[model samples]
Target chain A: MGATPTAAVLDAGNLQQLLDILQKQNYQTVGPTVRDNAVVYEHIQSVEDLPRGWTDEQTNGRYRLTHGKGKKFFGYVHGPNSWKKFLYPPARQLYAADRMKHRFDVVAPEPSGIKPALIGVRACELAAIMVQDRVLMDGEYIDPEYKARRQNAVIVAVNCTRAGGTCFCASMNTGPRVQEGYDILLTEVVDSHGHYFTVETASEKGRAIAAQLATSPASEEQLAAARQAVDKAARQMGRTLDLTDLKDSLYRGFDSIHWEKVAGRCLTCGNCTMVCPTCFCVNVEDTTALTGEQAFRIRRWDSCFTVDFSYIHGGSIRATDYSRYRQWLLHKLAYWQDQFGVVGCVGCGRCITWCPVGIDITEEARAVKG
Target chain B: MASKKKPTLAVWKFASCDGCQLSLLDCEDELLAVADVVQIANFPEASRAVKRGPYDISLVEGSITTPHDAERIHKIRRMSKTLVVIGACATAGGIQALRNFTDVRRYVSAVYAHPEYIETLNKSTPIADHVFVDFELRGCPINKYHLIEVINAYLNGRKPNIPSYSVCMECKRKGNVCVMVATGVPCLGPVTQAGCGAICPSFNRGCYSCFGPKETPNTEALAGWLHALDQRPDEIVRAFRGFNAYAEPFRKQSEAYEK
Candidate 1:
């Protein structure tokens, strides 16, 4: 439709123009912002809202933001909140109804007006989004709300130049560099020459937005530097989950003693599932006004670690913590592939960093494989 | 519809603070709507008017700390169609259950001028221990919305949609950064129940376990982390021995750490 999408270089100072253009297109920009001592995704109006000169130190059961010398916009890795919060929200009202002369009138929720421009999306997070797209959109029972929000949203993916201590995106083959599934991809480069972003337009929409910005053809040297930064990140991966027969090992490791040991330490708090980018379980509930005149149906995110998550007619199927932990680990590594034709985990390491007891999934997988 | 008699509700109290009953009164706007659905037959906190026993719903707040109240609960249980114990006092014996771990007479002799005059039981106990409780709503002072939810569920003949999951779930849902993970703070959120909506962590403080131990809470595991965070074993013991001290999981965990 237009000049073929090409790689270009935009100075760091001009990045704010991209935000303005996205806003002009009526897309609310949501990106990483430091909140409650950790970086979290929320609505942002300006590029200043992005975490600058800050990198995160994340290990099992720990996370802290460390401000550095240089001003790197997407300096840190992804945090607890993911792009799913903008798409598959934590809680939402499905419908409302009111009694009217023996017949109840149903009221559907108003269509969402906020079309989010998700900024600073990492490769692993993009992979997580793709995994969720397969689960929510490509399934027989389509989630209409997810489908609508996803179609409306725009992605601005950022290739990782530095990996957190808990990150293993390299092992997952999902990150360190943006491979695919992005409208616009950016690789941050801060070198002796200057600070800038090597941008690559993957779609016509991305090219149209880039055409509005002040950009030049990225030099061969700048592109190489960007590539080197990503390669450095790949080598700096702090953890790794060996994928060789990972699903088969998990399937056969059902009764392993490791499950019991993990269960003993596991609080069954559901923190892992909540922080996970791809955990898409939810429970629906109905509430009536005390007057009994109105009723509402709401859905909130649920986790398998909860006792009620596996509740049946008599009692919960996964009554023991051992079984529950085993089920979650197996499902993430084993059953997910059987059902969806892809592994569930994206190796973003949110589960490891957010876990209060420091349960490393990689270590658990290795122990299970034994 | 006029032929349908509204369900009669009775609010009763025992030896404890009336904060849980105050929670019902705190439902200022919703109280009017609640009144329309059910008859506020005998709530001493709200009105002077008292109705006869055999109430449709008996909301019990507080714990049995004396022989008189212990006997009184059985009678109330016989009269109530559905007896729901509200708050930590009625559900887990409240903070007064600390006396359960030690002799009650020494404290009585120390506080009261005349020990003979004080009539009390050695062990404070929850209503469930003395009588059959239909439901036990957990919290130091029960969440009013949850109280309303329990009432509504009872009226609709459905199970109450109260979550027994950990407070971490609520903290995550609120998009809160983990205080324990980020800082080396000792938090009870991982082992504590979710009813309080993680108010403490949202305020950048650790949870106080006001909602008690969640379903399948691994207190041993949490204690180990607390120890690693520089909390002494006694401090960990004291952490579990709070408002919900007598709750089975907390009691056992505190006892284990006591040594």
Candidate 2:
């Protein structure tokens, strides 16, 4: 995609230069920063703003941040924020209406003019964006807001060297190493010589940014080290979900007693769907002003676990917790394949770690297969 | 339809903190808009101008803790076309339902100057326990947005779009790290319904289950995990016995743990 060679070495000190180049090009740089005791995405102006010397410890129903050995900017695994927040926001006003007597005028929200350079994106997140692209951008009814934001985004994908306690991206075949869907790919390498990043340009825009930065041809040894780092991350996965004939098994196991067992501990809280990078369920709200002269139609994120999500004229379809849990699991693991040509889960483990009850999806999938 | 008429709305209170009813007033931006569409017929908290019943919609807050309130809910149910129970109080008996686990006579004597003056039922129960509830909005104090949606949906002849998901979803969407995981704090977010916008977790505190159990909460599993985390059985029992203590799953769990 670019004229320059695929690989180049960037000094750790010059990481700030890359941020400078993006800012100079009128792109708002969004990267990880320490907030609320966890690393979360936020606007950044310098490399210092990045989550340096901070790493996260994650387990089923738990997540904790810890200090790392050295000044490692990208040492932490994925936090709660996915690129979805920037693209499809939590709450958005579709249009506002103004009424004069019986006549009405509707005004749509203005398009966001700022281009965003997403820094420190992981491989699993890149896959998640692709899934969302299919749902929002490539669908029959394209969401103009999502399309505009996506078009203006520049992806800076980071290859993981360490896996969090709840991560299973390797099992999903969507992460640990970024193979595509990035403007520039970065692998942090710390050697006897010094700390640096082996950066690869995958797009023409990335190449332009690379040319402006202070970089040198990556030595074969540095490239090998970068490759080794990603391989280590793959080996360190916390869990794995087997996808062998998973769709058929999930469909067949609709009445399995296992569902009841899972439901026994499953709080039908839609946490899993909310944290899911690819989950795109939404509900719309219509509001009018007291004067009856103005109104607004707002769209916000919704989950299938809610009875209202399944409610109809008579009553709710999925009345029991067992049925709701079954719907979510089946939709994510099986039905998502039919709809998106891929499983909805990216195996980032936000669902497992953030779940108040610590219900593990991998464990459930395994039990269902059995 | 010959010239549509504005729907008459009533807000009723029983044995509650009146927080849920206050939520309706809390809709500062939309209250004026709401008033334009619906006639506030019988809201004692909002207005002194009392309007008679046979209302189009009745939002019953609180629960039945007294015989008078128990009899009152049924009358209101007959008067209103649509009856929606708002908050943990009206949906699942409120925190006052803790009396259900103990002797109310002894409690009355201990708190009141004259036990004879306190005429009350032994058990505090949800409004639905007394009359057929058209809908139940779950929360300690119901989310104002849900209240608006319920009124709007009823007026438009459509189902209200309220989520039954867990707080974990909102917590993640808010970009809050897991309080249970990060701080080893016990949280009811997994079992609790989504409505409070995961407020506790965003503030770095565990969920207190103010919205009640979601579609199906695995309280047993969570209790087991909490036990493994070294939490006492009494502590676990206390967790479930908060806002919606009388809610079935939580009630059973707390009863099982009670010594």
Candidate 3:
């Protein structure tokens, strides 16, 4: 609508001006903050709230916070909390019931009124969100709650310049550089020209916000620096899962005996699915007051690795540890393709880094593929 | 419909710590609400007034560790329309089940000056091992939310929605980075059941397997990884022999590693 979104250079000092514009629009700005020894998303009030000079070291089953080389915010890779916690939430009351003498009156919980401006979103996370959108919103039965939150939200994406020890977004072709799915995309560049962001607007709203900021047309050299940053990130990936016929290979390896081999080390902990950006299974629970006068229905995140997730009328379907592990891996890599037309993994590698026993998804995939 | 009678509920104990039963009492805010809907037929800890059962629902805690408890459970089962076992003690024989791997006579002699004064069983077994259990809630101390949900499901005549998955799921959902991969710590979260909300991993420690094994656990694989991490086989065996030593999958895994 306004001069067709162009590339502009913004000084790092003016980053607060961009956040202020979103705040003035009545959007609750949410961004990364240093909490519990990791970068976690919280309601951020200013640029100071962002995890500046803080990066992380991540490996299979391990993570540590470390200081960055410079005053770089968003230098760390993905943490445990994804944007899903804001949109879908860990727990939510679906409805409540008033118990009467004869029948019950059901009342649905009101939709969340907060409109969040999500800042510093990663490329793989954007892909993960898109995958979730397909599963939760594009389906026949849309999740009304997720729809409301997602619709009112804003996205400010950050292009990755550094990859974590567990990162494989390059292999998934989901990150290092963000192609789309952001209102405003920012590439942080630090050199002799000083610390600044190469900003590009994807939508009219983004352009309008950028227009309000003190910015200049990006030079050829600045753009090159931004591209090189992404290129370095791609080259620095610590893990890779070859996706060449990966879906079919996983399907074929259902009985590859590798399942048992991996299962032996697996504690059957659902840590991978929990840390995963795309895993979205839930279980519903109903609770009543002691007087039977009130009742509530709650929906909480569930995982396939649990025994009750597959509980049938008789017992359980996937009763063995190997079978449960196999179901989860196959569903993420193969079955998701058949069901969702996309692989569930965005190669963020949170699952690998967070596994209590250090079970690497890429390594397992490669083993089965072989 | 006007004269519908409230369902009766009872609580029973056996051979472990009373933590699981205390979890029910710890529902301080929800206790009054739960009490209003069901008749408290028998709960020695909560009320001194004991009512005879034929209880609509009986929540059993602890494991079978003595000949008297072994026989008493059968009688209790007969009186309960629905028998729900709560905690690792009742569902997987608790930490006391460590005796299952060793001789009880030796343990009694080692702990007591007069061994003849103590009368114990050769093995500590779960309630499910003795009689049919309608449902089993896993955890060192059963989650209060889950206890409510299980009771609600039974009263509503529906399937309880407790997950049998690993603690890994909870750890991930909580956004806690993996201690094993990042710190090279050994965690039993992979093979352990989900219910405790992945509490241990959230604190930057490995899962202690307080909830016992998930539906089907891969302890061998976990042990192999522990071995790779430079953990001795005996340490791995001791790891599995904790709270739920008598749980079949864990017991078998520990036995396999035992020299």
Candidate 4:
């Protein structure tokens, strides 16, 4: 609202119309659709691919699909997947090599040009993307592949009308509404009567799309609906995290008993990180065959839960689950604040919802802080 | 016969889950390039090309659980110019470090096929305990980027830009919400090092001490906070006695609970 431009909205039918315009403009329309068991963001050439009649019921660290009241394009929280898988592909071929006559020359992998238009981008995810952008793009050692993918992207944000059970965006001040970092923002309004989505454009690209497509200036009534919908979503959050006096507890509670309680229960399965949109730790591997004729290096997701995640030459510094669990929480809450000048999470709640043990961050925070 | 010119990179095994050494192979993009630069000396997991060591860089995985491993590491040190320990087990005895608290012999007899044939130590120690290390890269399984950095550093004749600071540094850099203060979640971020890039918090979970204690980490204060959360002192002691329990600060902290 300060230096960023004001919000704008298109009518309910603007979603389908927006798709038509993007298709015509030669942009790949990508948004949330039901894939696997949970909702995930994927490419859609038409409106048919959208999860037209799907909604979610969320609780503290739990989420499940409930029947949709009506046909709606966007009606979900941050899904099991985020924009990361496309922007930063899980596995990438860095280079290829061939051995000829006892002499070898390795060729760097070429960039694959893939421009994606990301619709239904959430506030928190956008923030996460920015964080990644800072790491991958802004740094001196830029990832050429990531740079190519991210620069060719279009952003369509959705004002959250339904916060998930594990959501604490209000506490983190990252969501329940699309604040910024998008070309367009939409708020879906559904009542006893019918359903319509109010869309707002925020960027130059967004304005061009709205101008090209036939659309009305969002009415005051439609604006009220958008506001009301976002309010409902904010109020619907299933859990809340208390950040008060957090730094002191993290600093003071080095040998807390709560860690043992958590460790006893934690499978250290690392599921929480794998499913998390922001969890970016990766382990490197080199795959080779029996003949040693060929090979390719790869990177896979790794987690701290595994005893192997924290090994050192002399030995692992944190040997038990209690210390491992403690390290994870303390870094997330206390140390992140100290180092980054920013809190480490946007309260998307993916980790809470996806954890196999259903361990709640809120519960652990209280245990350590109380 | 053609003269052997390539520097041999031998990956070894110890008492770990094989995840750490796998981290080296996980460098899918860099593997062949690294192989081209160095010979595949002795890696049982990847290839049959088991050239005997006297290797340039010996990447050892797992921990020293048996007398055989203890003796073998000495041989490896002799055969290797650079011995780099990979993963939790090799670095700090691994989850098997959990056995450090209870009786190893009794647990062995209770779980194994034949305790009579199984010869093991009362404590599981790291590779460094048995041999002099060129470098000790940290992680539950070391981050591939950091691993590459270390390799690159060795090649360039410099200290790897590995941070000794805790996971808190990474969480801050990633802009993750602090799981502890913001969510009141308990975490070990204050003590554990930064190789993990603050992953648990990125997912909205707390830091576990997967990377082990940082330099002069003020864990005592954080431990007091966990105690105030209504946890018992025994549990507090167990918190410190984790994957790197044999390591100093965590060992001392864990022992304090017993006292």
lDDT of 1 by residue, A16-58 (tens): 9999999999998999998878889999989889899878889
Query: lDDT (0-100) at residue A259 of candidate 3?
Result: 90
Candidate 4 docking quality: incorrect, acceptable, medium or high? incorrect
- Winning candidate number (TM-score): 1
Q: Sort candidate 1 into its docking category.
A: medium
**TM-score of chain A as modeled in candidate 2:** 0.96
Per-model TM-score versus the true fold: 0.98, 0.89, 0.89, 0.59
Q: For model 2 chain A, give the 10-residue run with minimal summed lDDT.
A: A285-294
lDDT of 2: 0.86
Model 4: residues >4 Å from true position, as ranges? A1-9, A24-26, A97-106, A139-141, A191-194, A289-295, B1-259
Please give the fraction of native interface contacts (Cα pairs under 8 Å between A and B) kept by each candidate.
Answer: 0.78, 0.70, 0.75, 0.00
Model 4, A257-284: lDDT tens digits are 8888877656444545655566666655
The lDDT for every candidate, in the order shown, is: 0.90, 0.86, 0.85, 0.71
**How does residue B211 of candidate 3 score in lDDT?**
89
* Candidate 2 TM-score versus the reference: 0.89
Candidate 3 residue lDDT tens string, A46-65: 99999999999888777888
Q: What is the DockQ of candidate 1?
A: 0.78
CA displacement after TM-score superposition, residue A309 of candidate 1 (Å): 0.5
